[model samples]
Target: MTSTDHDTAPADRTAAGTAPAPAAPARRPRRELAAATVGSVVEAYDWTIYGILAPYFAEQLFPGSSPTAKLLAAYLGFALGFLVRPLGSVLIGRLTDTRGRRYGLTLTVSLIAVGSLLLAVVPGYASIGLAAPLLVVAARLVQGLSVGAENPSVAAYVTETAPGRHRYFYSAVSYGGVVLGSALSFIVLSVLLGVFGESGIENGAWRYGFLFGALLGLTALWIRRGAQESAVFTAAAPGADPAPGPDGAPGKPGGTGGTGPAGAKRAKAPSPWPVLRAHLRRLTVVFAITSGATTAFYFVTVDFPSYAEGTGAATKEESSAALLLGMVALLLAMLGGGRVADRFGALPVLRVGFAGLALGTVPLVLAMSSGRVPVQLVPAVLLFLLGLPLAVSNVFAGQLFPPAVRAVAVGLPTAVAISLFGGTFPMLAELLRSAGHNDWVPWWPAITAAAALAASWGVREHPLPGEPHA
Candidate 1:
C-alpha cells in the first residue's frame, strides 16, 4: 500500500506496516513537577505541624482536662479538616476539570495561606474560652477546603507534564511531598523542643510552626507563579461558555487544545461525575485500596509520633530523634521508589511495597514498644520504608485517568478515604488503647497494607494521560 494508505489503515493493518513516529519528548516537564513537589511539601509542612504538635497544643488549649480528653480534642480538630476536604474536592475538582489546573491550584493555596495565618493568631482556650476551639475547628475547615482543592490540581499538573516512560516516577513526587513535609515538621519541633524546652514550645515555639506554614503557603504561591499551563491541558479543546474563575477571567483555554481570548471556550470531555459512574467498579477499587494505604501511612507518619510519646515507649527526646530519622529514610525511599516505578512500571513496585508495609508495620510497632536502645528507632525507619508501596501507588493514581477528569478521579475518592481513615485513625488508636486493646493497634496497619495490595493488583499496568479511558 502507498504511504498515504498506510496512514489511514486500521490498527491491525498499521501494525503490519511501519508505526508512526513517537510523540515529541516532553519539554522540561520534570521542572514543573519539581516546583509542584516543593509547593506541596511546604503546604504539608504547615498542615502536619498541627498533628506533630498536638500534644502540646492540647495541654495549652484544653488545660484542666484529662490527658486523653485534651489530646482527643486536638485530634478531632485535625480530623475536622479532613471532613471538609471532600466538599472542597467536589467543588474544586469540577472547576479543575472544566477550568484549568493552574487556576484551581492558585485558588486553593491562597485559602490555605489564609487559614494558616488565622491559626497562628487565634487565641487559646484560656483567652477566648468557648470560641477558641470553635475558631480552631473553623480554621481547619477552611484549611481542609484549600487542601482538598490543591491535591487534584497538582495531581493533574504533574501527571500531564510527566514523560510517558518516566511518568510514574515523577508522579511519585506528590507523596514524596507529604513525606518531606512530615519530616520537616518533626525535625523542626525536635530542635525547638530540645533547645527551647517544652516551656518554650508551649509559650511561643508552637506558634512559630504555624507561622512557617503561612510562609510555606506563600512560597507555594510564588513557585506556582512561574508555571506554564501543561501541554496536555493546553491541548484540551475548550467548550462554549467555559466555566469562569472567582475573578471575571475565563477558565483555562480548552485542556485539549485551544488558547483563545480571556473568554475563550473549547470542546472538551464531559464532567467527572459521568465518567465516575461509568467506571464505578474500577473507581471502587481505587478508593478502597488507596484509602487503606493512605490510612496506614498516615497512621505511621502522623499518629506514630504522638503515640510513641504518649505511650511511654520513648521519651519526648527519643520520639523526636526517631521521627527525624524516619523522615530521612522516607525521603530516600520516595526518591528511590519513584525511579523504580520508572523502570518497572507502578504495579510490581507497589506489590512489593504493600506486602512489606503490612508485615513490617506489626513487627515494627511491637519492636518500638519493646524499648530496646536501637530497636526503638528501627520501627520508625521501617514505617517510612513500608510506605514505599503506597507512594508508588500514588504515581499510578495520577496517571489513572485522562487529564479532563484526572483530578476528580484521584482526589475525590482519596479525600473520602482519607477522611474516613486518615482523619479518624489517631482517635481510633487512642480509643483502642484506652479500651484495653493496645496489642491490636498493629493490626490496623496490617489490614490496610493488605487492602493496598489488592488495589495495586487491580490497577492497570499502563495508564494513558490523555486517552479516552482510564
Candidate 2:
C-alpha cells in the first residue's frame, strides 16, 4: 500500500463498510491538554486537602466530647460534599453541553477556589459556636459541586482534544495530574506537621493547606480561560455546521438543516435527559466502571492513613509518608498504564486493573492486619493497581456516548456512584472499625472490583468522528 493508504488503514478498519472517516485536526492540542491537566491538579488538590487536614481541624470545627465524635462529624461533612455532587454534575454538565467546556471549567475552578478560601478562613467553633461547623459544611457543599462538575468536563475536554491515536496516553497524563495534586497535599501537610508539630496542626496550622489550594485553583482558572474549545463540541453544536441531508449531502440552511430560523424554532440545545434515557445501559456501565475504582481509591488514599494510625500499624507521620510515596507510585502507574492501553486497548487494561484489585485486596488487608509488611509497601502497591484503570477510565466513558450529551452522560452516573461508594468509604470504614466489623472493609472494594470486571467485558470503545482507532 502507498503511504497515504497506510495512514488511512486504521480509520478504514474502524469504519468497516461505512463512509470514510473525517480527517483528524491538523494542529496538536498541546495548550488545551496542559490546561486540562492543570485544572485536574487544582481540582484534586482542593478536594483532597480537606480530607488530609480534617483530623487536625475537626476538633476546632465541631463541638464534640471525644476525638472520634469530632472526626466523624468532619467526615460527615466530607460525605455531604459527595451528596450534592450529582446536582453539580447535572447543572454543570448541562452548562458544559450547552455553553462550552472552557466556560464550565472556569466556573468550576472558580467555585473550588471560593470553597477553599472559605475553608481556610472560617472561624473555629471556639469563636463561632454552632456556626463554625455549619460554615464548614456549607463550604464542603460548594466544593462538592465544583468537583462534581469538574471531572466530567475535564474528561470530555481531554477526550475531544487528544490525538486519536494517543488518547489513552493523554488521559493517563491528565490522571497523573490528579495524583500529583493529591501528593502535593501530602507534601504540604507533611511540611506543616514538620514546621508546627502535631499539636500546632491541631491548634490551627491546617488552614494553610486550604489557602494554598485556593491559590492553585485561581492559577488553574486562569490557565483554563486560554484553552480553545474542543473541535468536536464545535462541530456538534447547533448551527455550527450544516446538518446532513437524507443522502449525506449538507442540507440547506433553514430548510433541512438543523440550524438557522427553523432549527431555532425547534430547540436551543439538546436535552441530556432523552439521550441519557436512551443510553441507560451505557449509563449503568459508567456507574459500574466507576464504582470499584472510586471506592478503592478513596479507601487507599484518604482512609488508610488514619486506619493505619488507629490500628497501630503505623504512626500518623509514618502513614502520611507512606501515602505520599503511594501517590508517586500511582502517578507512575497511571502514565505507564495509559501508554500500554494506547498500544493495546483500554478494555484489556481495565480488566487487568479490576481483576488485580479483586484478587489483591484480601491479601493486602491480611498483610496490613499481620503487621509484617512495611506500611508504605501495601499502599504503594494498592494505589499503583488503582491508578491503572483510573488512567483510562474517563476516556473509556467518553467513548460510550456522542458529544451531544457526553459530559452529562459521564458525569451524573459517575457522581452518583462516587457519592454512594467513594464519598462514604472513609466514614463507613471508621464506623465499621468501631463496630468490630473492620475485617469486612476489604471486601467492599473487592466485590465492587468484581462487578466492574464483569461490566468491562461488555464495554467497547468507539472513536469520535474524524479520529483514528487506537
Candidate 3:
C-alpha cells in the first residue's frame, strides 16, 4: 500500500461512504499543454521582466545609490517578494488541490496582470519620492504569489492530463514557457534599446514593456478561464463520482442513478496538511531535486548578464546579445531534456542534466566572464542549456504525487527552494562579482546539482508509493 493509504490508521472514513467516480472523458491532452503554456508564459514574463529591466529601474527608482548597491537593493526587493511565496503556495495550492485547477490558474493569471499593471503605472521616484520603491515592492510581491501558484498548477495539469507515453514531452512545456517568456522579453528590450536609445528606454520604453506583459496576462487569463478541469481530481471529489455498481463496474460518468436528487454526492474539499505530512519524505526529495534547477535558471538567465556587464567582461550591448544566444540555447536544451526524459526515463535525464551542470558550470562561467562572443556561444552555452531541468523536473514531480495535493506538494517545496535560492541568485551573483570572486559563480549551481543527483535516487514515476520502483 502507499504511505498515504497505510498511514491513516484512523482513516478519514468520509470517503469510504462515498462512491467511486465514473470514467472521465478522454483527456484533451493538447488543451492541457496549451493552457499550461499560455498561463505560464505570462507568469515567467512577469517575473523575469524585472531582471531584464532592473538596471534601468534601479537608476530610475534608487537614483543616488552606487550601481552595485542599487542592484543589491533591487534584488533585495525581488528576494523580498519570494519570501512570501511559501504563504502563496499554502493558499493557492489548497485552492487548486481542493476547488479545481481552473480556479487556481485563473486566479494566478489575474494576479500577474494586476502586478504588471502596477509596475506599468507606478511613477518613478523622482515624481513620487519614497512611495515609488514601496509600490515596486508591492508589485513584486503580487507577482511572486502569482508565480508560486503558476508552476505547480501547470505541472500538475500536464502530468494528470497527458498519457503516460508522452508525459515528459508535454510537461516540459512548464519550463519551455519560461524560456519563451524570457526570450520574448529580451527581444523586446533589444528592440527598445535600438529604436529609442538608453534615455528613451529608461524614461518611457520600459513602461511600455510592462504594459505589454499586462496585456498578455489578460489574454492568458481569458484562455485559462475555459481550461479543462483535472479529471483525476474530478473523479476524486466527493459528489462528482459515484460508487461502484453491484456487477463490479463503477457508476456512469458524473455518478450513477440518473440526474435525480437521489444521485447527489457532496464534493469533499481536500485538506493540504495531511497529504503533505503523508508524503513528507517525497516532498523533501522534490525540494532537493529542484534546488539545482531553481538556482541554475536564475543564475544563467537573470544573473549572468548583470555579472558580465558589472565585471567589465562585456558591454551592456554585448551582454544583451550573449543573453539572447543563451536563451536560444535554453530552448534547444528544453527540447532535448524532454526528448531524453521520454526515451530514457526522467531519472536518467535528471542525472545527466545534473551531471553536465556539475562538470561544466565552472568552465561555462569562466568563458562567459571573458566576454568574447565566440567563447560565450560555443560549447560553454551547452552547459547552461543542460541546466534546463524544468522538463525533467516537472515530469518527475508530476508522477510522484496523486492529484489531491499535487499542486501544493510540488509548489510548496519548489517555492521554498526558489525563495531561498532563485530569489537570491542575482544578488548573490552580483555580490560575488563585486567582491572580485567571479570564479565562484559556477560553484553555487555545481554544489546544488550534486545534491540533487543524490536526491534523484528517491524519485519514482508511479502515483503509488512503491508499486513501480524508481
Candidate 4:
C-alpha cells in the first residue's frame, strides 16, 4: 500500500496482536486529475471575463474613442497585468513549495475574486472621468497578478497528482479549461445580447458581466479550498518548498534543502541565483519559443475579435455574432486538440497547427475583409485552426520543466511573449491596414507558423512522475 493509504489503515491487530490491519486501496490518480481539471476550468472563467467585456467597456468608458486606439489601450492594460505574472509565479511558487499547493491556489483564487469584484463595480468614464479608466486598469493589474502564478501552480498540482501514463491526458484537461472558459464567455455574452440588445449591451449591462466573472472566481475558490495539499508537496523534505527559481533551486526561504530520498538534509540550500545562472541557456530557449505561442494566442483570441468587428465592413451586432460563433468552433477544436497531442506528441501537433494558421491567416483575413457568404465562415475555420496550437501549447508548456522550476518556467515565458507579441498584434494589424497594407494581413499567420515550428522543435518532453519521456 502507498504511504498515504497506510496512514488510514485500520487499527485492528494482526494475529500477533501488534500489527495494524491492511489498508484500503489508494485514491487513484484519475480522481485527482478530475479535481484539478475542474479547478482549472473554474479559474479560466474568471481570467477570460475581461476579454469578453473589453469592447463594451471601450464603448462606455471611452466614448467616441477610436475602436483601434481604445482596444489597444485596454489590451495594453491587460498586457501590463501579464507583465507582473513572473513576480506572481515567484511569490506563489515559493509559497507552494514552503507551505503547500493548496495554500498558493487559495491565495491566487482569492485575489481573482477581489479583482473581479472591483471591476464589476468600478464607475464608468462619464461618472468618474479619467478615474474610471484608471480603476479598470488597476483592476486588471490585480487580476494579472492573481492569474500570473495560476498556471504553474495548477500544472505542478496535476503532474504530481496524476498517474504516469495518463499524465498527458490529465494535463490536457488544463487546456480544456481555456476552451471551456472562452466558450462560456461567448455563450454568456450571446445571452446578454439577447436580453439587452445592442444598446443595452453597450450600456450598464456589461458591468454585470464583471460581477458574473467575480462570482465564478468565488465558486472556484470555494471548491478548491476543500482540496488537500498534494502528496507530492507534503512529501517535500522537512523544509523543502517547491517554489520555483529562475533555475531549479528550492525558491527563497523554506525551499527544499538538498534532501535525499533517504531523508538526509544537506548543509545548505542552493541559492536561486546559482540555479538561474546554471540554467540560463535552456531557460532562454524555452522562454523564447513558448513566448511565441503566447503571442500567437493573444493575437488570435484577444485582438482578432475587435479587429473583425471594428473593421467597418460589418455591423456591431454582426461582428459580435461572428465572434460568438468563432469561440464555439474554437472550444470544440481545443477539446479535440488535446487528445491529438497526447497521441502524436506536442511538437507534431503544434507544428501542423502553426503552419496551418500561417497559410490560413491570409484566407481568413481576406474572408473577413471580403464581406461575402464564404467570408463569414472565416471565423469558424480560423477558430478551429488557431485552437490546435493553443491546445497543444497550453498542455505541453507545463511539461517542459521539472517541478522545481515549473511555475517560473511556464508563467514567465507566457507573460513575456504575450506582453510583447499578442498585446501588440491587433494594434499592429490595424496600423497596417490604415497604412494601406491590408493585403499583408495574411503574413501575421505566416509568421505565427514559423514561430510555432521553431518552438515545437525546441521543447524537450521530460519524464513525468509516472512515465518515461517519449
Task: Please give the RMSD to the true structure for each candidate, in Å.
Answer: 6.6, 6.4, 6.6, 6.3
**Candidate 1 local lDDT, residue 376:** 48
Q: What ranges in model 4 sit over 4 Å off?
A: 1-25, 28-31, 59-72, 237-270, 309-316, 323-325, 371-376, 430-442, 460-466
Ten-residue segment with the worst summed lDDT in candidate 3? 4-13
Off by over 4 Å in 3: 1-26, 241-270, 367-373, 378-388, 460-470
Kindly indicate the candidate among 1 and 4 with the higher lDDT. Answer: 1
Please write out the lDDT profile of model 3 over residues 167-257, one tens digit for every residue.
6777776668887888788887888898998888877678888899999999998887666666555555445433333443223333334
> Which candidate comes out best when scored by lDDT?
2
Ranked by lDDT, top first = 2, 3, 1, 4
TM-score of 2: 0.88
- The lDDT for every candidate, in the order shown, is 0.69, 0.81, 0.73, 0.62
lDDT of 2 by residue, 50-132 (tens): 88888899989998999999999999999999999999999988888766677788999999899999999999999989999
Highest TM-score among the candidates is held by which one? 2
Model 4 earns a TM-score of 0.80
Candidate 1 C-alpha RMSD relative to the actual structure: 6.6
Q: After aligning candidate 4 to the native by TM-score, how far in Å is the CA of 91 from where it should be?
A: 2.4
**Displacement of the residue 434 alpha carbon in candidate 2, Å:** 1.7
The number of clashing residue pairs in model 2 is 0
The digit string of per-residue lDDT tens for model 4 on 64-159 reads: 457767766775666677667767767766566455566677788788778878988887778888887788778777777777777667777775
Per-residue lDDT of candidate 1, residues 197-253 (tens digit): 888887767878888888888888887766655655644535422333233222355
Ordered list by TM-score, greatest first: 2, 3, 1, 4
